[model samples]
Structures are given as structure tokens and as C-alpha cells.
Target: MTVTETSATALHDDAVRTLEGWRTADAGQDRLRRDYLAHLAGHPDGLFRACLPAHITASALVVDPASGRVLLTLHPKVGIWLQMGGHCEPGDPDLAAAALREATEESGIPDLTLLTADGAPTPVMLDRHQVRCTGKDRPENTHLDVQYVALARPGAEALISEESLDLRWFGYDSLPELTDDSVRALVARARELTR
Candidate 1:
């Protein structure tokens, strides 16, 4: 389905309340807050809006089960190793679907499956971060983040997108050396949820 058509799923009330709290907490970023608010209003069940205090607008963590590794992208703007994800566009009906779309687009992995925290198709952790949304058009684009996790098989080849400078597979245990503390936390949380 088209991106806009896909992002129309309703969000839960708890998710809305969480998003509203973040908007109030980070009022300085008006444009970002407004855009996020608009996104939340559209999906009452999508909780990414509420869990955004962590520095993500939205995210998808792809794990490779065979190798016990995770697919990580070196974000061009943020300059860090992160999952394949971004803002929940108007067309992404829900966070899980959005994560899948991002995995396909960023990693060029076809038919990637999304798993839950419990190693099934379940909801994972919501990680947050702070980001300065740079570039020409988005002056007010600073981000408070919310992250999610998904699982894929090993040996899945990925085509790096412009958003990322590099893509690589890292063992879950060795991830600490390649990424920062926050990302490490995300990985740790994903591992816990998956375990």
C-alpha cells in the first residue's frame, strides 16, 4: 500500500497522552512538536508519539536471528549506528508497518518480518533521543525520539540508502564497541525483549 494510505491506523489513548506530555515537555521545538502532534492525532494506537522523549521521531531495529546480529545503519545526519527508521510519515498506518517499510527502504531487505519484544510479532521498547533536524527546509526540525525493534534472518543483504553512510552486521554482544551508550541501551532492551 501507499505510504499515506498505510499510516492511518488509530492510536491508543495512552499513546496520545504520552505524546501530549512530550509536546509539553519540549515546547521549545514548536515545529517538531506540532508535526508530531499531527502525527499522533492521526494514529490513536500508535504509541511512538508518546515515547519520543528519547531522541527518535520513529525507529526500527532489525535483528538477524541466524547470526545473532542486528542490521545497523550509520545515519548520515546523526552520524551514529542506528536502526533503519525515521519519522512516521502520514502514510505509515502504524509503527510496526512503518518499521517494516523503513527496513525495506534503508536496508534494501525484501519481505523483512517484524518481531515483538518477546521474539514474536509483539511491541518492543520505545527508545528516545534528542536530535537536531538539520538541512535547508527544516529549520524547526529538532527531534525527540521513539524507537522499536524487529527481527530478520541472518545473511539478509542490505543496500545502504542515502540516509546512511554505511550498513553492517554487528553481533549483539559486540555492539557496545560500535555504538554509543544510548544505542547500546536500545540493543540491550531489544535483546531482553527478544529473549
Candidate 2:
């Protein structure tokens, strides 16, 4: 009854197409895009295994349209304020669905939806960052993250999840100063997309 053999293949194919169709001028992102495409071509199970040298992750920046504020979760393992997202699960249909699912689960806002362009979920960003590995023999891992911007329903209540130390919204002009360049870049791109 393992779903990976079939569903995982479809999701991987969809992810490949999504990455191929994304438009970007950033050199680093372009590199990640190429690397992700290569990884998918090389590893049939790349979408599901965190133990792989590199794997696909889907995440999103959740913004409250009425207030112009973005929600961030204080990640317990990483110890930083970040967008709601994580590794793709078996039930996710595609990268965008995985991102939306992560946003809903992490932000506790089930009504969250992607900000679409021409009625399609346009990729807002791609990031590749090293993370401490969970595998028994691996010391580190890489995440090829497909990022998106999702709009949260106004007055939606956010409950702190087990994965987060805290959850809060910050105005665009008033984000915390300690976040890394990737988070800042994601927020900036998300703001531009919303505008």
C-alpha cells in the first residue's frame, strides 16, 4: 500500500515541469533551478527522501492582504523566524500544493491560498540551503526549495504548532533584523508579487 511508487513519480514529474517553467534572472536561483532539474533527472526518489544528497522542499510566505503583514514561524530547529513550509509529504499533489499544505499546517490558517498570476501559481522564488541531516550516516543535506506567496484570510487565527517556537506577523517595514538573506529575499519578492 505504499503510495510513493506511483504518487511520488507524478509529483516529481510535476515539480520538474514547474521548475522548468519558472522565470528567474538571479544567478544563484538559476543555478538552483538547474541543480534541481539535474537532481530529479539523476534520482528517481529525489522528491521524497531527506536522506538524499539534495531533495525538494516546498514553502510559502503567508501574507495578510488587509494588514500588509507577513506571518513567520520561529522554527525550533533552525531558531529563526521563517515562512511556514517544510518537506513534501505523500499526499501532496505538486510543489504548489505542498507549499499551500505547509502554510496551512504551520500557520493554522486553513483558508490560505496562493497569489496566482493568470490563474496559475507562479513561483515566487527558489532557494538552496544546507541543513543538518537526519540520516544516520549523513552529516548535512541540501534543500532545493520551491517558494510561493500565499494570502491569508483576514482575521484568521494562527495557533502555535509543535514545530514552531512562536508565530507572529510583522509589517514589511518592520521585520526582525536577525534573519538571513534568503528570508529577506523571499519577503521582498513576496511583497512585489502581492503589489
Candidate 3:
């Protein structure tokens, strides 16, 4: 294999192991985890391709430590407040790196750091959600999201990205009413993990 090909293969291997070994109390998440692993086993390009039946996504709950608030983006396409995340890029070594990169990029917080335990950032939640198919949209299928928690630098400012209509920080107890259950669950899991 060429160097790029080998690196991609190694990233796929890491994803397989990470998904296979993740533990979850939620039966739905557990099933999605299995389904994701199976999809990867069957499809060589499953990890990075957006048009797969279900593709792996990496996301992070960006929390401010001092105020215990979470940074959320108003996703234009989805039309909902959601965590910072997107499809896995070929340059991402693993899910955690992908999540961190997405959080930083989406929130425009360059100093955001993944909350780590035992010196390694860990996955805090797994989610599978359907996306409304826009004409010829890339991710017309479900998203199998591997979620992590990140901390923003104190007094950090957020710049809205073109992908989002707005970016704001919400208190843990007072998240926007339009926030979906999956994102709420992710926030709860993030709070638990970071604490």
C-alpha cells in the first residue's frame, strides 16, 4: 500500500477497534455501535464516505469549565441547535481527533481541549439519527455519531461558521427548547464524564 493508503487503513482499524470496544448502557446506542462496526466490515470506504447508508461522525460538546455552559451551533441544514461535529475526514487519525477538530473548527475556539481521563480522551456517547434528505444531499442516510466532550478556554469567543446560522453558549439547566433529545443526552453524558 502507498503511504496515504496505509495511513487510511490504519485509521479504519482504529475506528473498528474503538467502536467494537465502546460500552454503553443504552440498548439503542449498543445496537448502533454493532451496526456501525458491521457496516465498516462490509464497506471499505464506510469511515470517510458521506453517502454511505450510515457513516461514522465525530462530535464534541464544548463546555466552559468556569460557568458549566455548553457551546452549541444552530445548524442551518438541520435547523436545530446541535453539538459541533461532522463527517470523519481522511486526515483524522481516530474518532477523538475528529471530534476535537470539528469542535475547534465549528466553534472557532482554537484552544478547545478534549476532556481526558487516564491521559486519553474517551468517547462519552454514541448516537444514531436520521437526516432529512435534501435533493442529492451527501448524507441522506443515518449518522452514527461518536461523541466526546471538550473544554473551551476561559473567556473564549466564538465566531459563527458558514455551516451554522448562529453560535451560542447555553447553561446546562437552560438549553434551548428546540434542542433535540440526542443532543441533550450528549450534554448530560458530557457533564457526567467531565465531572
Highest lDDT against the true fold, candidate: 2
Which tens-of-lDDT digit does each residue in 49-89 have in candidate 1?
Answer: 33333223556788776677888998887677888877655
Cα displacement (Å) at residue 76, model 2: 0.5
lDDT of 1 at 18: 40
Residues forming the 10-long window of minimal summed lDDT in candidate 3: 131-140
Cα-based lDDT at residue 165, candidate 1: 89
Q: Which sections of candidate 2 miss by over 4 Å?
A: 133-138
TM-score-best of 1 and 2: 2
What local distance difference test score does each model get? Answer: 0.61, 0.85, 0.83
Q: Per-residue lDDT tens digits of candidate 3, residues 97-116?
A: 99999999999989888987
List, residue by residue over 1-195, the lDDT tens digit for candidate 2: 367667888888899999898878888888888888999999877877553778888999999867878999998877888998889886788889999999999998878889887788977888888886474465788888889998988766788889799999998878887578898988888887777
Q: Which ten residues in a row have the lowest lDDT in candidate 1?
A: 47-56
Candidate 3 residue runs with Cα over 4 Å from true position: 132-139
Candidate 3's error at 35, in angstroms? 1.9
Positional deviation of residue 135's Cα in model 1 after best superposition, in angstroms: 2.9
Q: Top TM-score: which candidate number?
A: 2
